[model samples]
Target: MNYTAEAPAVWDPEAFTDAEDCLLCADQCVVRAQHYFVKGMIEIPVIGGDETFSWGVWVSISRDSFSRAADLWDTPGRESEKPSFGWLTTDLPVYPATTLNLKTYVHTRPVGERPFVELEPTDHPLAVEQRTGISLDRVREIAAAVLHAGEDAQR
Candidate 1:
């Protein structure tokens, strides 16, 4: 039998930091897409009436994890809590499906000569319901925390 070695995956510098961050953690954990499994759901604040939304979470494997996804998912444990990768979003301040369309694959590079792969709103309802503006700020906060943690670890 013949086998081929896989190339190591490099994390996206835009989405991740040299230090620890949410994107970095997510990348290390192997989250490829922010999948919305459920529809029209929201998360509530501890004190405020403000609600958070969730479609669901999508976890994708890297070439590194391709052989391990089955083993990991099959084993006892929920994927979200121990997700391949994920991000939680709020229901309020939601971006209209029309407003937030993915023009190209922001997270991944093409395997061949393809310039870009665009995803439309109809392609998947949750695919276009991206969190932006303030929501993105929140995401950045989480990433900052992760980055801070990583820096602390180095010291």
Candidate 2:
């Protein structure tokens, strides 16, 4: 029942630098500390299995939502806050269609966990998987298709 898959590194170029305009860490990103974002778990249930297949992904959220999340970040019961609107900023290459800018509702989890990002119900395969879960075979297929494509180019 191992579910600790490696989350992809942030792909946005602005996050690559030590510049003052942006901040990108293991679990959060901020621009001018105003255009805020946080990495969250996009979990697709595994059909007939014990664990979910997940993508640790980032989303662009509003200033207000960001502020509220920061305020309650260390506080207990932070999970009670309403979900906030966000745009899926991560581009998952395994999908046939582009996965960026998709609508999402970001749910804050308790302290010590990433937020859960719920994709809007749509016909897109990724969104559908988020809503209805995916088969384990499909997860393997996706992993095989995209996981190693850029390794050589990076070096």
Candidate 3:
């Protein structure tokens, strides 16, 4: 699933906040209020065959979390690394859940350059969703649904 932009999708702050329940907190949380949304694809190698599939991915996270995670990635002799918190939704059959560490296997360039995040190969269904292409509208819809589901679960 190559990351070709299907259509432009605007961020609905109100819907996102409602689904994420941002109002429940006394103070603003970076993960809920501020984060980077991105879409991309990864090539997966198949065993015993010369075949590969382009897996599309959708992710969002705050700069603070990304920086903190990057610091941890560089730090030596660290007891344990903190998982950079964020949303990791995707369009792959192997992945179903939409919760993942946004910092895992990430890549980026200078300030003026475009940022991209790569998903690490894992057997666990971590932050994976069954879908194709990179549609901001689809991403927003999924986020809304997931967050809304969370909100409903709490009620």
Candidate 4:
């Protein structure tokens, strides 16, 4: 299952005032040319199922880190690069607590695929779910939530 976010939580590229300073594309983002971010997938394996459920999220990286990732973006064997540390910028609504600012590691994937984001082991429900796995029912719940959210937006 693949559900992706268009941008980081609470940051609207459409409403951004400083167009010159902020950049938000489908895969990469930079705010004020200082705060750098990259889109990645945080996948949760389905219990007793062969597939996975993923949240298309963003991770905030440093300027140097972003530069390194950018340099390797189109280069072959970029997946061989070590995972870069960053903070999770997406806010997931499925959990009660805020999902923002969690520690994470972003691993570059092969060409045409977004990076993979692994959250730091923590007591948070999302982290626990990532460490372990979620149920098919959980996936249905997430799907229903997302569908309703999209419907709400259209209203």
Candidate 5:
């Protein structure tokens, strides 16, 4: 199933009520994907001393997404061996291509800047501000709650 990069909801301050939630969500979304789920994070140094990283996320069907994923997945000498983040479906014989592993190439922030600053997808007004230097208070607040929950070990 080929897919496209749909920016996730803006990181809500309230949505992340505690550190545990932040850590857990981030861990599940990225670290775990790389460490245990066979996905990988590849970093490439761009001209300006800035680096771009491909945090494999999903797959695509067209040149736009496919090209972007390909650029992110690019590495010297072993382009064909790069990982696949999504799959394409096709009808065929006994060994049809039923599955295609797609990888999400999440862009990293420019040097000394924050990542995802230009890609906020939500109705939250705070998200707008966040792109312009505002801190994510809602996420911090939720992170606090997550920590408390962990401390109490609620049922």
Candidate 6:
């Protein structure tokens, strides 16, 4: 299912204990107080086949992680890059019970405006399950609960 943020919310960094873990990390990570637009899961069907798989989706505006990635993307003689948005998705499991399967990508504009470019493949799953035909409201509920759970864990 497709998602679009009507009124995005900022996730306070202080709400999470591991907010600093993203810093200097090799993978693209989301920071606190960043505007998260969409968060949900989708089931991907194999083309021309009956096989199907699930993936969790997270989309947000660029923050510290994006800046770090852009800085790293710059070379001695190459043009500087500025990413404005980020998209992260869980990978299809090789097995149904695989863990820590996710990937990240970025773009110069909101995902609603332009496509995102792959920054790097990641393996940090949010422990969310993929469900088909879920409503946007339900997705938001799940996202909120996940964030709240993180905050509670930090406290």
Best of the candidates, TM-score: 4
List candidate 2 segments past 4 Å from native: 1-16
**How high is the CA lDDT of each candidate model?**
0.29, 0.78, 0.41, 0.89, 0.29, 0.38
Write candidate 1's Cα lDDT for 1-155 as tens digits.
11111111333455544434323332223223432211111121212224343222222234433334433433443232222222222221133343222232212222211111122334433343332212545444445654675688699
Report lDDT (Cα) of residue 47, candidate 6.
40
Best prediction by lDDT: 4
Q: Choose 5 or 6, whichever is better by lDDT.
A: 6
Write down the lDDT that model 2 would get: 0.78
What is residue 63's positional error in candidate 3, in angstroms? 2.6
Q: What is the lDDT of residue 102 in candidate 3?
A: 34
Better of 2 and 6 by lDDT: 2
The pairs that clash in candidate 3 are 1-54, 91-131
Q: Can you write out model 3's per-residue Cα lDDT over 38-141, one digit (the tens) per residue? A: 44444444333554434445445567754554454434443244333335543332235433443344344333322344454454443232212334454455
Model 6 CA deviation exceeding 4 Å by range:
1-56, 59-62, 65-101, 109-155
Report how far residue 116 has shifted in candidate 2, in Å. Answer: 0.5
Question: How far does residue 11 in candidate 1 sit from its true spot (Å)?
Answer: 22
Candidate 2 lDDT by residue in tens digits, 44-128: 9889987888888888889898888888989999999999999988778778898888899999999998999999999988899
Estimate TM-scores for all models. 0.22, 0.86, 0.35, 0.93, 0.26, 0.25
In candidate 1, stretches whose alpha carbon ends up further than 4 angstroms from where it belongs are 1-52, 57-60, 77-155
Error at 64, model 1, angstroms: 2.4
**Candidate 1 lowest-lDDT run of ten:** 1-10
